[model samples]
Target: MTGTAPNRPEPPLIAEPLTLPGCLKIFPKVHRDERGRLVKTVHHETYSRYGLISSFREQFYSFSRRGVLRGLHVQLPPAEQHKLVACLQGEVLDVILDLRTDSPTYGQHELVPLDGERGAMVYMPPGIAHGFYACDDSLLLYHVTTQHAPAQDAGIHWNSVGISWPDSQPVLSERDRTFPSLAEFASPFRFHPEGSPL
Candidate 1:
């Protein structure tokens, strides 16, 4: 069983499967000594053995001041994206919504606390909508298989679903506020149990 979950105590990097069918919670190797710390965020071969091997075409950062709320967003097909996300500074209450109609967890959302000190990351396949709250001044790093496509950019309103975000009045942008609610938009992605990459 190469893609084992529940965290292996001996491996330097681990991917724990979440409730969502194709999502993963990744723990990277961290070295700590008198010299402080070093976090190794990714390694293709190790991730591959865990059923996660992405081309990762682009890398970007999202910096949020304390109390900022971002996303609940996704890209449409033809420009869909596979994402690897990590909060490298501060911490965040990260959430993801599964939109694949056939998935066991469709329409359900799961959350995990991504702390800078913990060095854990999240991997989301194409149809998943993602969002997070900056518990403190946080910096999130993202790796995606596709470049940003404005025309294909899409999202569900952060408050449309039943996510228990930590902030009652977090900062928001006009664009994020305008996305359709979960009940309003029709999903264009599907789940393939035989393992379509996303």
Candidate 2:
């Protein structure tokens, strides 16, 4: 005698919410059973429904312990990357900085609480700085439109932006610790240069 297969569950829809510099893009929530849980990071159709263009070229995942701070990082023009960052395991205080001098929100900031349970994602366009502090043991998954470029990568000191970071002595890598304050470095991204692609 042959046995019938069980029906599969459908993924939840992505949610977009308001933020200071850009929208908060979210992946669908996953339901679990005795077997396991399932989640989808990107669906072209769903992203399109929200006016998101551009293809994902690379994927990255980082794990951080509580009170760990990652970055206020961004790549320069010609290597600028748009990212979709989500918390997959725990919670974080995600922050973004608007670097577009021409943008109405220039020098603005946004903070959001992201976690595995919320399944929230942040979509950061080029010309913005992004960073986060792990509020709990956290796993962050990011999808990028461009591959990593060492020379083009740049950042501002986490404390330079006037945002209050929860960790006073957060652990940081040598590279992350070496970046100059926003005012100390010459920015590589311009809002309206004569030949810019924007």
Candidate 3:
């Protein structure tokens, strides 16, 4: 809610596909003026057209200093989530992994540049795991479709995958660092194609 110009009508969000199926790089419309800028991050009508989950059940953000890396995570079956993640105060090298066994891009990963200043976001389906490396002191916002379910929460170890992190010594939480590597993770989330919602 930092930037708001309610009187003006914002354009619809622009969605671009990433290498992985169901993963998208989104650019919400931003209006600028002599004072500053106004960003419209969500619109149910426009978002739903792209198959994004607009009825977010939870919304929060995280602040990370440079060299901090977080995630490669998702929830299990019956508690999976669709996410719209954005960087609101800095930039990050965002990473997304496709975990759907049936997906053509299964086990494939993609790198996206999320910038706070420019206002970019990523939309990921349930069968994907996401993580990021802060290139600056970044503030990341997360809008998830499902509430947190601790028992179903899970993740793959950061180093297990072949991602080339910007920092070899990124600050990590015990849980993120200790997650099972890609080879050890047994994914329970499944994918549905274009017209379907998982």
Candidate 4:
């Protein structure tokens, strides 16, 4: 008698230019069994093949309640980070702003609706600032190319960029509320048409 073959799972899907140059939205494949589910959020080879940063020196995560907004943040160059962000336990409205002064998309913004159950991920290139609004009690994970440096920390004011945030009064840390508006601040980052130094 012949035996039946085992099942094979499909690979994840990667959608590029989710809004800005080098930005990507990844839909990870989730395999479910009686035990639970398994997901492969990163494939180093695939990332490298697409010219996305694949080396992550640090990993961190955050938990936030609905109405909480974190960021509009980035590390200054010499320590700027390329991050892979994903929602792990709820939902969020993920946002990014292009701060590369010479790029055509500079000062532009984009939003990606992220849901933990779908396991989608966003790749944010070095010259962009990022933030998120919790749509529910949310958990977000980050794989970053550089370690955090207190002195290099910086951000643009969240409301200054004209983002249509869902909440009128978001709960914010004092620091997040204090960054200068984009127009008043001068960016040190310059867009490199060839590619960013990895």
Better by TM-score, candidate 4 or 2: 4
For residue 79, give model 2's deviation from the true position in Å. 0.6
Off by more than 4 A, model 2: 1-11, 190-198
RMSD of 1: 4.8
CA lDDT, every model vs. true structure:
0.88, 0.78, 0.86, 0.87
**Per-residue accuracy of model 4 over 61-133 as CA lDDT, tens digit each:** 9999999999899999799988999999889999999999988899999989998888888988788999999
Model 3 scores worst on lDDT over the 10 consecutive residues at 189-198
Question: Which scores better on TM-score, 1 or 4?
Answer: 1
lDDT of candidate 3 over 1-198, digit per residue (tens): 769866865556888888887778889887789998877789888877766778999999999999999998888879888898999988999999989988888888888988977898988888899999999999999999899999998998888878888888899999998899888888776668864432
| Model 4: lowest-lDDT 10 consecutive positions | 8-17
What is the full ranking by lDDT, best candidate first?
1, 4, 3, 2
The positional error of residue 159 in candidate 1, measured at the CA in angstroms, is: 0.6
Task: Flag the better candidate by lDDT, 2 or 4.
Answer: 4
Question: What would you estimate as the lDDT of candidate 1?
Answer: 0.88
TM-score of 3: 0.91
For model 4 the local lDDT of residue 126 reads: 85
State the lDDT of candidate 2 residue by residue for 12-82, as single tens digits: 55666555434455767777788866677787876666666449888989999998899988888788977
Kindly provide the TM-score of model 1 when superposed on the true structure, using C-alpha atoms: 0.91
TM-score of each: 0.91, 0.84, 0.91, 0.91
Pitting candidate 1 against candidate 2, the one with the higher lDDT is 1
